[model samples]
Every structure is written in structure tokens, then in C-alpha cells.
Target: MSLSAAITGMGVVICGPKEIPDATGNTLSAISMAAQEAGIDLREIDGLLINQNELIADDHLTLDLSRRGAFGTLKVLYELESKGTTMSVLLKQATEIVNAGEADNVVVVFADAAISPNAPSGAAFASMGGDTGYRGLERAGGMLGAVAAYALIAQHYFVERNADIDDLFAVAQAQRSWAVENPLAWIREPLTREKYDAAPLVAAPLRRLDCARPVSGAAAFIVSKPNSSNSLNPVYVRGMAQRHTMRRRHAPHSPWRPVGASEVFTDALKQARTTADAIDNLQIYDAFTIVPLVMMEELGVVGPGEAGSFIAAGNTRHGGSLPVNTGGGQISGFYLQGATPLIEAVTQLRGQGGNRQIADASTSMVVSVGGRLESVNALVMGVQQ
Candidate 1:
């Protein structure tokens, strides 16, 4: 496949809950690290793109702060925002900028300091809508938070597919298996089915292990022309597509159906001029176990309602036919929204995944969904040889 843009560099920063760095600190550090890996001078980075977490203060994370704190001047700068769809969208923007000759190198960074002591993630998530008027109504109806919202989706999926708790357990177990190999993973201990089954329920049908634990950290990647000699490893972007299914219009008819994912994944593959068979690894935004499970089926590589069983059969673990979320995914890894998936893909594509690396993983597919599946995006990438 012809490459449009490729990730040349990447960096990560982990901060403890008490020492949470503001968006600027995280962004500057991560971007500087990425720039060095790309073999480019900091001043040569002409573009800066920031993906601020929904929970962070917008005023605190501005392009002005990023520029003043790091790169003095840039050809392009912008702060991208969304609940979970920011990663792929930011990448697409960076690709467009480079491909159009607007900039030679664009650093995409996601910096978040939302983690707070004794704060419930659900409560913080509820505030992301900017206190929109609908928030009151949603909360009044016992929607509670994202966890509760996803639990409803999980319930619908279970009934439709005849799946039980064991299916969810498999997803969590496989992720933990990978996490044990990831030094950055927050929880790397083996996950027993017994423990998964007995974990305290955060939302009905969704246990504590099912949801991604929020962490304070930053991740950044440098995007540039594919196969640039400046990079030790260049993970090229092959295809990209996005879709937004109006939930109000489709929820009543197909609340449980992942129709949007099917469309987006297919379009992405078409854009890459490749078949699904070429995708050897996946780095999907798995905020919850069922999220990727449903995506596996919706992507059509796995049969409908069979993703749970597919995972249970050990097809997604390391050394399996299609190792998924090789960095343990968001469920086991720290939750950084879309960056969680992209980071793993870049590492594995660069042959830097270490113990969790998939064997000869040349191509990887990435998927990110936003707001209870209201919006979705997919990207196909290949390791530049």
C-alpha cells in the first residue's frame, strides 16, 4: 500500500496522582521527546497539535501555552477536542497538513491531568459536556455516567448475542496477559476468571476491571512523510475513515448494532487498497472490553456475535492469530483516550513492543469510537520497510 503519512517518533510521560502536570508541561515534554526520536531539531517542528482531555480545563490547554513553553514559532497549531474521537481526528489533520506541504513535521500530543484524589471518573466524565442543559436530564434519569451508559449498551449486546459474563472475562484476561509485559501498565497482575467474575460492580454488567482506569499522563507522536530517513522506524498511515450515526435517530431501531463501525472499517480498508487479511495486529480504543468485542464483529473479519467467543478461544492474545491491544489496551493500560491504541500500534510496528510484541506485525488497524458509539473512526497503518 502507498503511504500518505507516517509516525516518525513517539514519547510518553507518566505522573503520579499527587504530581499531576498541567497540559503544557506534559505536552512540551512529550513533544520534545518525540522530536528527538524523529532526528529533527525542536525548531524544525513547524506544526503542533494538541488533543486535550475532556476532563481538563480548556483555557489551561491552549496553543499559546504550548508554543510559549516549547517551540517558539510554528507554521501550524491547533487544539483538537472531542470525548474520545480526538486521536484519529488529530492524526488525520496532521496527515493532511504534511501531505499538502503545509508542514514537514507535525507533533500530535495528548496531555491530561484529570486524575484527582477520591474523584470518581464517572462524575468527572459527566462534566465533559460543558454543563450542557441535557446533562441535567440525563442525570435525572439515572443515566449516572459513562460507565452506567456503557453498561446499558453491554446489556443489549449480551441479550442479542446470547453472551454471558465469561465473554467479558476473556477480554479482560487477554488484556491483562499483555499488560504483564508492559512496564507502563497500571495493573499488570494476571487476571483470573474467578477474580473477573467476582470483581465489584461499577455499573451493572460492567465490573471495575471492564472499564479503563483513568491516569494522569501524556503521549505524543511526530508525523511526517512516509519512509523518512530521519526516523528509526516509520509506521505509515495507509487509510482512514470516520462516521457519526445520529443516536437519536438510530437508537430506537438499532441501539445494539455496530453498523457505523462496519461502514468505517470497510471504507478505511478500501482507501488503503488492501483486504482485511493484511491487518495482522489491532490497536483499537477499547475503553471497555465489550467495545473492542463488538468492533471485532462489526469490522466483519469476525462473524457477528462471535467476537466474545473469538476472544475466549485465545485468538487475540500474544502469539495468537490476531493479537490485539498489545500494550494491554486502555482496560489494562492507562486511559489516554485515542492515544492508547495508537501508542501500541506505533511501538509494535517499530518492533519495540518487547515482551508483548506480536511476531512480524507489519500492518495494524486502529479504531476509536466516541460518545456511546455516536461517532466512530478507523485507520489502517503499515510498517514502512
Candidate 2:
């Protein structure tokens, strides 16, 4: 018999605008909570997986984009005083380690503290300049950062699809509406189309609300053998898939090229032996307003260029056909890259989402993106029967 991976515990510490804790503090708190919920002592954890360590030092947010390379493993283990084996693995590999019997109880932690008031300016990061050698070219062309890059896509999308900027406004408004229900959300106020239009434009068609807030927080989850879980709801990892075929590809042609979201979602669903309709909830990555739109098209949830209309029709909100990012997502929720969506999916599947829980949500889908949509990964999780 093959082993299956299931999430038995989860912990999230979000730093709101008024109160922001250090990354190290948030990380420890998150780990302790997850371990407690998993019915295990902190010292009993045998495996550790860390995503990123965006430490909050002197009220400044510093992120080691390499996810701390090898040093991170040593630091986390030392700080936690754990005798467990430690390894840094991506989303898909974490589940594999547990399923392969290499680890019985694996705890994955991700801490980001980018919302501090004294955080470094956006120019301090090289990725903001563009990828490596292209930095100079992008800078010379007046492309400042991520917003500029996605703005280029937005421009092309509008021109090709005859879409309006109002679509972007709708996405921002929808996310805010969802955020209102989430206590951990940073921005919970209602947003109107008029308010969205009044907000300053960061990049041409992309308004300030269109971009996700880089807040400070940490999230951790326990992936263990299904039989080891004692929680009221054990969320099993039904399927997982990732595609990196376009990581090296750049813009202009990149946006028009086929995206990995399609293949990853299909492969994950097939591995789960289910179709998209079975997914009761979706926690799609929301780095920008356009990201989920593109994903919806590729995921077959909506036709190409019709995501705006689909969302406007309330297909993604609570009580809609497919509730998406019911816990505010990265846009209105904390931006921990893909970790935010992963945590949200687990919470919903566990039926512990409070006001954001989808009615009878037994199956959930989560997709994450990295490197400006260069790489995409998808995971299917279900409430274990």
C-alpha cells in the first residue's frame, strides 16, 4: 500500500498594519502552534521544510530570495532547538518526502516580514530590475519593477482582448470584499469601482489596488501520514504537479505563449482522479489583478479573455459557482508568495475558516506562481474520508 500525505496542523501569524512582529518571532509562534495542533511536541518533529526567511531586522524587511539556500536550514534548526533532520524543499517535494516514507511528520515553515514601516525601498532588490542580464535593458526602457512588467502584459491583454481597465478594478473590489470576512486580512474595508478608479495608477492600466501588499507574517503547516492525524478534518494531498517550461522565457512573446497553469492543473486533477467541477473551493495565487484572470482561462474555469465577465457575474465570490480565495488571497491578505494560498486551502479544507469557509467545502484546489508567472504549481487536497 502506498502512503498518503495529509495536513494535520496549521499555524499562521499575520502582522497587520498597526502591529507587525519580527519574522523570527512569527516563525516560532507559527511552528509551535502547528506542532501543538498536530498533537506532537515541538521536539518530536523529525523533518523540517522551510520556504523563505524574510527576516525583520531593526524594523527593516530583508528577504533572501534564494530561500536562505543551505544556511536557512541550519539557522531554523538551531533556533527551534530541534534534533530533527532539516531540508529545504519546494511545495511539491514536501508532500513527496512524507509520502515516500522518508519522513513521518514534516513541518514546513514560511516567514515573510515585508510590511514593516521601515522596510527597504523596492529598488534594493535586483529582481525588481528584471532577471539578471536583462536588468540594464529593462531599466533603460523605463521598466522599474514588477508592476511595470505586468503592466506590459496588461497593455497587451487589453489591446488583444478589447478588455477595459474596469476589469482590473473589479478584481480589486472583489478581493477587498472577500478580505472583509477574514480577520487576518490586512485590508478589510469595502471597495467600490469609483474608489478603485480614484486610486492612483501605479502602472498605466494597473492601479495601486491591482498589486498585492507585501505584508509581514509567517505560516506553517504539518504534512504527515494520514493515519497519524487526529484533527477533526484531515486534509489529504490528493494530487500535486508543477511545470517550469517557461521559466527562462521573457515578456512580449511570453504572455502569448502557453502557460504552465493549464498543464499543472490538468495533471493534478488527473492524478486525483477527479475533474475541476469537484473542487468546492479555489485558492489561486493573486500577485496582480491579471494573474487570476490568466489562470482562470488556462484552468478552464472560464473562457479566454472572459475572466473579467466571469468575476463580474460573481462566479468567484462566496456563494458563487467556485469560491476563489475566500480568505482574501495575497492581494488583500498577506503576501507570502504561494505560501498564503497553500495555507488558505488547508484552512478551508479543515472547515476552520470561520466566516470565509465555503459551504461543505470537502475538496479544494491551490495553485502558486513564481518568477513573474514563469513557473506554476498546482495541488489538490481533500477532506479525508
Error of 2 at 23 (Å): 2.4
Instruction: Please provide, for model 2 over 18-136, each residue's C-alpha lDDT reduced to its tens digit, 9 standing for 90 to 100.
Output: 56557667767887788778887765666666653322223322333123322222222312211111111243555677777776777777776565455432322324434447866
Q: Give the TM-score (vs. native) of candidate 2.
A: 0.85
What Cα-based lDDT does every candidate model obtain?
A: 0.81, 0.70
RMSD of every candidate to native, in Å, equals 2.3, 5.4
Question: Candidate 1 regions off by >4 Å?
Answer: 1-4, 58-60, 117-123, 226-231, 249-252
Candidate 1, residue 81: Cα displacement in angstroms equals: 2.3
Predicted structure 2: lDDT: 0.70
Candidate 2 — which residues are off by over 4 angstroms?
A: 1-3, 18-21, 53-91, 119-132, 226-229, 247-258
Q: Pick the candidate with the highest TM-score.
A: 1
